[model samples]
Target: MIPAIGWLLSSFLVAWLSARAAIAYAHRRGMLDRPGQRRSHSIPTPRGGGVGIVVASLLCLPGVLLGTAEPWPPRVLIGLLVALLLVALAGWWDDHRSLPILPRFGAQLLAVLLFAVASGVAGLSWWWLPVLVLGGAWSINLHNFMDGIDGLLAQQAMFVGTGLALLAWGGGQEALALAAGCLAAASLGFWCLNRSPARIFMGDVGSGSVGLLIFAFTVMLGRAGAWLLWPALILSSAFVVDASLTLLSRFWRGRRWYTAHREHLYQWLVRCGLTHAGGGVIYMTWNLLFAAPLAWLAWSHPRQALPTTMGAYLAAAALWLLLKRRCLRRRSNKDRHVAA
Candidate 1:
């Protein structure tokens, strides 16, 4: 308990201080995100604040492993760290200068493939290997997509990390639980600077690295049989639903899905008079009121996990459609008023 508490505190402080430093450095370097057509803010703000998050998480790795009461295999830890660093470096590069989609995606694919190979995912089935690799890459990109709003990505990270920690701890996976706990603490510290009326932006580095970390933790838990995939999916239903539905919507309309736009439900909600913080709170509320309970049920009852997960996603899908309809209706009404 003492070591765990120490780990959490140290991680939080490191992230917090690092974020402050990142803000200063970004401003000094003139790495600012100016308000634009597709943006949510009015004033320019410092970007790459997520460098602090990435740095803090990396710095705390040794302590997280050492402080764990139950030891993890050295190989597993080393592999996961290598994958994280790779993704973070790639994301950091993108943050500084936009990389072509193919190269950026190639980097993500390579990192995921490395992680899969390191984790012995090939033994599951040769076919499953490609699916996992692609899925890992999607997770990274989806997370980066969702980081558009203030506090949204950071808040979601906190919820997911804390949820993972609780589930792993309940399942007696102490090392995994500790890692998740550290993730939550780091996110919380960053969230202080990331919240609405934001002083800094997380940029690609924080979001991409966090997405990979979540994927890695879920895989680790699955390998340990401490939890199955269903609960993890349920825990992340909010992001899964939003990102998946939005992508499908764009693809169906024959829009260049890779292009950045403010078409996400969360973005629509923002356009409909919700403040950045308000939009973030709404997402956090969904996770707490809807996703969290269902995830808990799935985690606690393996036999019912599948049905519970399906039900959870079904509800999430319904909510997504409803939100879309409402946002569309609001836009239509505003258009009519403009025509008048």
Candidate 2:
């Protein structure tokens, strides 16, 4: 317990101090995200603050090695580190200067491939490789898409990381627990400055890396016990439902779904006059009220995990549609009133 606490504190401090440095660096480099039609904040903010989280996450390796009685295979450890760095470096570069989509995506694909190969997922069967590649890439992109508002991604990262830590600890996976704990603690450190009226943005650097970490943790948990994926999925259902539904909606409407836009449900919340913090609270409320209980149920009753996961996502989808429609109507009404 003492060691775990120590690890968490160390991770928090690393992320906090690093994020502080990132703010200075961003200012020096002019890596500021200014307010615009597609943006949420009203003022210019420093971005690439996720460098702190990336640094903290990388520092988790020593703790993992020291904390776990059973160490990860050398190949797996090296593969994970390299993969994380690949994503972070790519994002960091993009934060400074936009990279073409093909190159950016190529980096993500290569990173995921390395992880799949080193984790032995590639050796399992022909089909597992594609699943891991596609799912890992999708996780990376979805997180990037969801990083629109201040503190939302950080808060979500903390929530999912803590939830995954508990699940890992319950399963006696000490290394995984430590990794997840570090992730949560690091996110909390960043969230201090990230929460509404933000001082800094996560930029591409942190969001895609976080997505990869979560995906990697889920893969580990699923390997521990396939049923464990249920709780993980339930924990992530909010972002999954929102991002997925929004993407499909855009694509179906013949819009360029791959392009950037402000169409997410959370974006709508801000458009409806909710503060970023308030929108964050709304998502957290769902996590606490809806996602948490369903995840607990899935964790406790492994046999019913599938049904629980399905039900949770179905409910989330319904809520997404309802709230999105409501937001649209509210915006329309406000527009009509202004025109009147």
Candidate 3:
């Protein structure tokens, strides 16, 4: 217990210090995200502070290998590191200057392939490969889409990481628990600088890497116990629902779904007059009041895990549609008032 606590504290401090350095570096490099038509913030802010979280998470690898008695191979550890670096490096490049979609996607796919290879996903047979590749790619991009406002992705990462950590611990998976705990702690450190009225944005460097970490955590948790994946999805319901629904709606309406836009439910919350912090709180509230309880129920009743997950997602989808419609109506009413 003491060692675990120490690891978490170290992760937090490393990320905190890294975030400070990233702030200075972003300023020096002129990597600022300026306000624009589809942007959430009203002022220009330095970006790529997510590098702090990435650094902190990468540092946890040695701790996990050394501290646990889990007999993982050195090759696997090295592969994981290489995979993380590939994604982080790609995102770091994009942070400095936008990359064309094809190149960005190529990097993400290669990282996913590396992750699968390192984890011995091929041993499960070739079929799982394509599914995971697609899922991993979606996980990477959905996070980038959802990271439009201050502290939102950080908050979600902390919540999901902590949730998975506890679940892994309960299932007697010490390595997975430690890894997930480190992610939560690192996110908490970045959150200090990332809260509303932000000091620095996470940029692509942080958001995409965090997404990959969460995906990795979920896969490990599922490996420990297949039933646990249901709860993992439950914990991630807020982001998944918002992003998936928004994308589907855009596609259904024949909009360019691949382009950046202020159409996410969270973005609409900001457009509806809530502060970035307020939108974050709303999402966090659902995690706590809705997702958390259902996750606990799923954990306690393994037999019902799948059903509980399905029900939770159903409710979340309903709420998302209702809230999104309300936001649209409010915008329409406000527009009428302005015209009158």
Candidate 4:
């Protein structure tokens, strides 16, 4: 417990200072994002705020190695670290150079394979493999896609890390809990800078790293015998719904799935005249409303009932999306007319 607190404090300090420095560095380097068509922000904001994410995560590694997590086998940790490094490099490259989508997505695939192999994904039932792979792919891209607004990715990370840590505590994986605590703490500090009307943006590095970490954590927890998968999905349902639905919609319309666009649910909300803060609040609300009760049910019900609870959430998300999209279209038309 004390170790977790120590890590939390250190991670926050490092991430905060790093973000402040990145703003200046990007500004000096002429790396800011200027507003234009298909953009949300108005000013040329200094970007590449993922600097904090990389710095904070690297700082946490030493503590994880030095702490009680020692028994978790060095190779697995090293492999995971290598994957993160690859993603970080890819992210930085994307930030500076704007690498094509295929290459970036390729690196993410490699990371997913690395995590799967590292944690013995073979041990899981066959049914979960395709879902796990899809989930990993989903998690990575979803985070990147949802990074449109400031603080959204970091805020999502906070809730996710907190949820994983809770399940870790319940499942007696103390070391993992400590690691999650460090991440959650860093995310909070980063969120201060990332919040709407943000001082800095997360860029690709923060978003990719976040998705990678969450996916990895899920695998690790599943291996540790925690059956609380329902709650975990609930915690992340907002982003999942938006990204998946948007991608499917694009595919149905014969649009390329790999291209960047502004048709995401949150983007639609913004198009409908909701401020970024308003969208963030609504986005987070679903997580609390869905995850809280689902988490309780995950802990309370017998193992056999897990499927039923999870199914209910799937149905609910589907229904919510249908209604929400209709609402957005109506308001968005009005907004467009006003602008016209």
Candidate 5:
């Protein structure tokens, strides 16, 4: 207990300091995100603040692993750590210079494959193996996609990490719980600099690495039989619903799905006059009001987990449709007024 508390404090401090340094470094290097057509912010802001998050998490990992009482297989722990490092490195590289689509995706795929092999997915049915690999890779990318506004990604990380920690603790998975706690603390630290009227952005470094970490934790929980996948899905329903629906909508319209665009419901809301912080608040509220309760029910009643999970997604999907319609209507009204 004492060691865990220390770990959390250390993690928070490390991440905070790292983020501060990253902001200064970004400014010095002129690694600023300039305002553009698809952008949400007006002023240039330093990016790659997620470098702090990635650094802090990795630095604290050894202590957390050693201090925890839970018995994790050495091989599994090493494999996960190595995979996370690879993903973080790739994201860090991309933040400095845009890697082409194929190379970027290839890196992600390679990391996911390492994760899958480490997690012993090969023992699963052939079909399940591919599904797990694809899902893990997609999870990493979807996080990058969702990181378009201030505080959104960081706050989401805090909520999901905290939820996972609580769930793991409830299930008596001490090691996993401790690790998740550290992640939550680190995210909270990052949020200080990442809030609206932001001083710095997380860039791909933080988003990609954090996404991979969450997916890895989910897999770890499954392997331990401490939690089911449904609850995990419910916990991150906001990102899942928005990213999935937006991608499908784009693909259906024959748009280049890989292209950068501000077509996400959250993005539309920002364009419709919601401040960046306000946009983040909406997501946090959804997690508290809708996703959190359902996640709790799923965790407490494993038999009902699947249905509750589906219910959460359905509600999120409905909300997305509603937001999209409202955004479009507002645009149409402005257009009509202009014509008048």
Candidate 6:
């Protein structure tokens, strides 16, 4: 318990210091995100602020592992570190140079595959091998897709990590929970520089690491039982719905389904005059008002999966309608938003 508070405070300090350092580094390196059409931010800001996130977490890694009974293997450490080095470098390259699509995706896939192999979580059977690869690839890609805004991915990651930590403590996974403690602390600290008009964008480095960490925790949680996946899925509902619907909508409109665009519901809200802070608050509120209940329901009645999933999906669809309509209405000069 004492370690919990210690981790939180220490991560906060680390994040604050790291953020300041990143901002200065970005300025000196001229790694700034210039404002433009389709961009919500109005001014050029320092990007790659996620470097701070990596620094803080890397610092906490040893602390979480020292003298632990269930120590992570050297292979796992090497795999994660090596994978991160590649992913972060690619992301840094993207932020600095608009990396071509195919190359970027190739790098992303290679990193995820190497990390999974390094962690020794290879497929269990011949049939499941392809499934495992596809799942890992899709999860990391979806994570990258969802990291389009300030505090969105990181905050959600923290929420899920904190919730998992709470469950681990209750379920006797003390080491895992302590690890989660470090992640939660690091996320909150990252938020200091991440909220509102941002000092730096996390770019790919922060978001990819976040996705990987959450993926790791989710796998650990799943080993308790498959039912546990529901709550974790619920906690991640916002990203799934936004990304999924955006892709589907684009497909429906005969647009390139995989190309970059600002048609996402959350992106529309920001474009429709909601400040970054306001948009983040709105998404966070929906997670609490809707997504959290789904998580609770999933945990409480793991076998009654259909109803719980329906409720969560319904909530997401309802929000999509409400937000999309509100933004379009604003564009059309409707006096106010209508509840769905």
The candidate maximizing lDDT is 2
Across 233-309, the per-residue lDDT of candidate 6 in tens digits comes to 77777777887788888889999866666788778888778777777888788788888877877877878755797
Q: Give candidate 6 regions above 4 Å deviation.
A: 62-67, 72-77, 118-128, 257-259, 333-340
**Which regions of candidate 3 are displaced past 4 Å?**
121-125
The whole-model C-alpha lDDT of candidate 1 against the native structure comes to 0.85
lDDT of each residue in 170-221, candidate 1, tens digit only: 7788878888888989988999999988989999888999999899888777
How much does each candidate deviate from the true structure in C-alpha RMSD? 1.6, 1.3, 1.4, 2.6, 1.6, 3.7
Better of 3 and 6 by TM-score: 3
- For candidate 2, write residues 1-340 as lDDT tens digits: 8877888998899999999999999999999999899988899999998888999988876558444787656676677789999999999999999988999999999999898887784233445778989999999999999999999999999999999999988888888888888999999999888887888999999999999999988887777777788999899999999999999999899999878788999999999999898999989999999999999999999999999999999999999999999999999999999999
Error of 5 at 248 (Å): 0.4
Q: Is candidate 2 or candidate 4 better by TM-score?
A: 2
Clashes of 1: 0
lDDT of 2 at 158: 98
Q: lDDT tens digits, residues 1-340, model 4? A: 6766778898888888888888898888887878877777788887778778678878786567446843465655775677778787888788887898889888877876666665554354555656666677778778988898767788888888888888777778777777777778788888888898998888887788888778877777776775756555666767777787788889999997777678887777776677889888876787677665677677557484478556746865686678567867798788799999
Which window of 10 residues has the lowest lDDT sum in candidate 4?
120-129
Query: What are the Cα lDDT values of the candidates?
Result: 0.85, 0.90, 0.88, 0.76, 0.85, 0.72
**Which parts of model 5 have CA positions greater than 4 angstroms off?**
121-127
Q: In what order do the candidates fall by lDDT, top score first?
A: 2, 3, 5, 1, 4, 6
Question: What are the per-residue Cα lDDT tens digits for candidate 5 across 175-260?
Answer: 88888888989998999999988889999888988888888888777766634667877999999899999999999999999889
Q: Which stretches of candidate 4 lie over 4 Å from their true place?
A: 121-134, 302-305, 332-340
- Model 2 score (lDDT): 0.90
Residue pair clashes in candidate 6: none
